[model samples]
Target: MGGAPERADGCGARVRGRSAGSGRLSVTARTRGWRDRAAAELAAAALATREETVGDVLVVGDRTGVLARALGDRGAAVHRWGRRLGEGEVVSAWPPDGTVVLSAVRLPRSRAELAFAVHAAAARTRPGGTIAVYGANDEGIRSADRALAAVAENVTTLRVGGHCRVVAGRRSEAHADGGPDVFAIDFELSADDWGSQRLRGCGGRYRTWPGVFGGAGLDAGTRALVRVMAGFDRSPERVLDFGCGWGPLARAARALWPDARVEALDVDALAVRAVAANAPGVEARLGDRVEGAACYDLIVANPPYHDGKEEDTRVIEALFSDGAGALREGGCMVLVVQRRLPVPRLAAARFRRARPLADEGIYRVWELVGPL
Candidate 1:
């Protein structure tokens, strides 16, 4: 919308920390276009003046994350929520109310994600403070508006410069229609039946949550990883499920090697929570990369290549190097990824030997050994 909002001349990338690959650096991309449009449209609104937005503008669920800097440039003390790629600070909890909360939707999200953002925004906004939501017309704005009516008073809509609509409402009640509470985070999930398959666990269903990768169901590549992994022998002393969404691989490792230490790591808080809550004995941690001196005998992952809607290989690129560092000498790493990725080249840089172990349609699994 609005000719794809112009990129800020000084806008650039920022690295939050790092991910799995030992040699790779995972940096957040500077996403422009629709994000800038939403920000610009908000600024142009009568109520979104410097006096209203400055020193207290809070943007949530915005993946592009361009608004924070844009507001900062305008002298507003800005606070942002949600993950930008894999980079973000651990916000112990939601900021208090009495501040303007601007929740904009980016990157297609499940209904659970949208509901959480909306209710979270409402709960964090003081009664009488503003809560503005922006979204593309086709991005379920109408459904959101219907839901917003429950928490806000005198709701109204305005068409913005982009093919977007800004729905402004004042926070009155924290609960929306008494339908669900504000902090309804789906911490425990039963993987949905996508197509014909289910990522079932020995206890029946694997646990997952909203906002986690493959939370809804297993993707094609993960399916391949599970299929290939099932065939491997179960004797590893310790295993790390790198970038584990909800500990599928970690669960698998645990099931196969009942005594092995199965650890799962992910950047998403939701995923971390699910793994901790429903994954039972599996160890779970946050952030994109690994820490600690414990070396893994085997590392399994279905690494993410996209940051939000944009294709970002930096994490994957970094994983090759970082993952190698997490393993002990003679240890091995098993991974599944899209065939187009230069896995062999990246793997060769870290592993002593890297080769494809299986192929399923567009996905490939590689078996790589830690250097001697």
Candidate 2:
């Protein structure tokens, strides 16, 4: 961590190296503090326990590229899988034969997500190669050994510190068949739930993997939002589905406004791929932020409220602010959320006016007009 600041490492994570001719230090930029704890612990554990040089490595769920940069500095060729495009390669499915010498995973929030990551790592690692998983104890690092045991052997604790733990296991030669595909769950959305006359025959099939919100089916909030869209008097020429999960809003928007150009944006790579598969013809972009001010005619969203297992309002707030900025002068943004959240207040903070559209007891829809 001690060195002059260097240029960004293409993945948006900053890298620090020695000045001029001096040799580089092992520490990379500590941009994400506590969020990088598990990654730091895994890097330390891997570097210490391995008898030989760290060879080809695969890092998963290291959102900030903490482990990837650290391992790369130690002479390991690192490959990273992440949610956003700039973070790493956003692959829907890892190649079956892309085996590596070592793989490090930062445990995800959902158990299904954790299982998918661990199984993928194990399958892609060479027989007897190392698979290391780490996370905070409260975030379910305690179950790392059990999850790895399904696809690996000789599971053991590697390191424990800073309320985080790293567990390692040898990739079992028997599980070379590869892990579950990214599109692991398939479900159909009924036209009746949409409540739109235009969408009566547009019922479509959708595929989703673990971790994406509303993966099981169309959630009640999104359904309510779509219903509200059906009643709009004006047909928007351009539509943006911000935080589009599986592209339900984008699909409905396309069906309702046939001539409108529809776009979908999401941070998750799997979610972006699902949108492409489920809502064909729409532009699905893998990004963490909304681009272009005053570019969209209509924006629809069901912004996420959680940063993991913990409920955080910053996600929704940022979406509101950005969506407002992305709308045209005559455009509006529609949103749905749990009634308990402060949607009206959040909208008022960014838009000139906030109008209530529908309230289904548990979920409420709002229309925000004219960015301030």
Candidate 3:
């Protein structure tokens, strides 16, 4: 209806064809189910009219397996950025002009995440272009509507259906500041301060404010893993900090093995940025997987086990699988987790060997490795 037309695919599902310019469209989704629902809705809208022209479509956020499955019915170029997109993270650079940008994001629980969502929504929409956001009732959909209205030129709650509400807005001017408190802050980490830093179990203190992992204090799982890590031969030339939160493990690893080059990867862009700020010397990248062919001698992670508000293990599985593939022969993946999680079972199937290295009463360090 917005000048875009939908065309029918051979699979009988309606798919939107490309539009003018780059003909690229962007859909930011929350979970796998939501992604499927949104894609179906968009596909239906696109096929009924067959007028919307889109060359490429990019879906950003978690449970991309669902996004891939939903897009499977359509014959179009599709790419995905996996779980937990941070502030200002855009899956594609497709301009908002004459584009259909759909966001199925949950309400932000923290002020930092809220600011990030606002900025992300604004960046995806062009002047006078429409952006749609859908969320469940309890996720503060109403509050989200209010917040969007305050920032955008025209905002409206388009629909509320299936226990979910859709809010649409258009930005005619620059985004009003989400307020100074939510703005990014500068973080400095130094050896001088490291001596006093108290990050989880690391006796040396590290400075990290809110929004960073283990920001409030150290989690029990990380503290347990750090203690057991000392028992392993720590002299590896290459190491990977999968799901490195706030650079605590990176900081500890770097201190123990000064000669090793450590690579930190996290799904949260904000976390990645924060880690970089706190550990300038440590190589950190924002992404879902371990990038590059250089296998690490050691891979450590406390992979995320939650999605939005529910307990989900998809992200953790992805990291564990990737870590196994990214480790060199005889290299080890040291992971810490609550004993209740079936991580050992998951690891046993994925790794050549998996066993508990140490149990700290609450958490256990699961070590998986190639033929030891």
Q: What CA root-mean-square deviation does each model show from the true structure?
A: 7.8, 6.3, 9.2
Q: Put the candidates in lDDT order, highest first.
A: 2, 1, 3
Who is ahead in TM-score, 2 or 3? 2
TM-score of each: 0.73, 0.83, 0.65
- C-alpha lDDT of residue 229 in model 1: 68
Q: lDDT per residue, candidate 1, 113-222, as tens digits?
A: 66565666665565766666666665655456666666677777754555566666677754543322233344333434222123344444455545667764567777
Superposition error at 203 for model 2 (Å): 2.5
Candidate that would win on TM-score = 2
For candidate 1, the TM-score is 0.73
Backbone clash count, each prediction separately = 11, 0, 21
User: lDDT of each model, Cα atoms only?
Assistant: 0.59, 0.71, 0.54
Instruction: Please identify model 3 stretches exceeding 4 Å from their true place.
Output: 1-31, 34-111, 123-131, 170-182, 185-217, 230-233, 291-294, 350-352
1-372 per-residue lDDT for model 3 (tens digits): 112333332211112222112442211123235533543354333232221113233333323333333443455333333224321223221223223333333345554554455555555444554444445565566667666664465677766665556665666576543422354554444443333233323443344433556664457777677666655655888887877867777767776677898778664555666566656577876455453333788888887776556677876776665567667777888988878889767776568888888787778788888632
